[model samples]
Target: MSTTTMKYAVTDSLMMLRRSMLHIARYPSMTLPLIIGPIVFLFLFVYVFGGTLGAGLDGSSGGRADYVNYVTPGILLLTVAGAATATAVSVATDMTQGIVARFRTMSIFRPSLLTGHVLGSVIQTLLSVAVVLGVAVAIGFRPNANPAEWLAAVGILTMLIFAITWVAVIMGLVSDTVETASNLPMLLMLLPFFGSGFVPTDSMPGWLAAIAENQPFTPVMETLRGLLMGTEMGNSPWIAMAWCAGITAAAFAGSVALLNREPGR
Candidate 1:
């Protein structure tokens, strides 16, 4: 694309982004669960399970601090899935609505619509993550990450948000209804629980440990934990990046292909 065309695409994307943002602003119910659910989970884990699970994850010396630190990153990633699920619902609703057909006949850049939804979802996910972090801070959660480490953490999270939002987008595209679209990402939200998110993989049974150690969520949680708590991450950073990159690329390609396909085909 030429400079002018590129500029127009960017402008159009921004406008579409604004539209998506407005939809969020107008519907507080859509955002409320994203903010509240994680906060509830944070409280539940820290207050209820913290004492017992704390012992398992960390010995007496590390105790509660370890649980607080370990759970924070996992909850943060869950917040990302919440935001993506919302976008999936929005995209599914858009696909089912007559307005999409109207837009199809217009001279607008179609890619901007999906781009706008993705950008808007990422922004919302970051905001939700911040809220969860704040809640964690209000409790006893503390991290030793320096400024540079903090920046790297944010970069990792942005990639995660980007990667998952596209998967949500494709789910939205494939589903025939908004309800179906929303369910897929909800299933994704459970990934953290099964991985090394809340606890160490070694404590799990041999077969379960093998699964948890190899999965994408474990790598991501490990990377985040390493960044924040100054733990040794080994190859988790590289593995996490590889997982996110591959998922994002595949999902983006699938979304574009599905979007370009004829409605009745």
Candidate 2:
């Protein structure tokens, strides 16, 4: 791209980003569920199911604390899943409200619309993750990671959110209704349960465990577990990053293609 075009794209994307942020501020209700869902699960699992689950992990009577540590990473990933749903709904809302069609008529960089959604969702997702992490710490979830590990955790998280948000943008782009967009990302929410979010793959049946072991969420969860709690990560971090890269590239291409073909664009 030429420098002038690049500059224009950046300017338009920033404007779109500001617009997205304002929309979020005005409709904070859209974000509340994303934050609340993980918290409810955290409390539900820790207080109600922690003892039995924790005991299974370490064979101790006071296993609730251990369970808290094991479960927090999954809950953190859940927060990102919730962000995906919110992004999809936001995009769908824009499409249905005729705002996207309106934008296409303007001379602004066309990609800026989706770019704004991705950037805004990243900011929102990270803030939501921080809030959830604080709650986890309050409820006996502890991390022994140094500054570098903490930074790595944040980096992986941001990458995952960025990748997932692009996928959500595509979901939003294709969805005919806001409700459909909200529901489309529901599968992401179940990923942790199917993988190693709430429990270990070894504990699952062989067939189920195999599926869980190979899925995206397990590696990401394992990476987080290692970073935060000093658990053994092995190749999980690299695997997780690879998944993020692949997903982002595919989703970005799909989103751009969809936008190009969009009616009235």
Best-performing candidate as measured by TM-score:
2
Alpha-carbon RMSD to native, per candidate = 1.3, 1.4
Q: Provide the lowest-lDDT 10-residue window in model 1.
A: 57-66
Error of 1 at 244 (Å): 1.1
Candidate achieving the largest lDDT: 2
TM-score of each: 0.96, 0.97
- Summarize candidate 1's per-residue lDDT along 1-265 as a digit string, tens digits: 9998898789989999999999999998888899999999888888889887888865445566678988899889878877777989999999988567777898777788788999998888888898889889889888989999999999999998999999999988888998898887888888888888788888899999998888778888999989999887999999999999999999989998888788867
In Å, residue 151's CA in model 2 sits off its true spot by 0.1
Q: Model 2 — which ten-residue stretch has the worst lDDT?
A: 55-64
What C-alpha lDDT do the candidate models reach, one value each? 0.87, 0.92
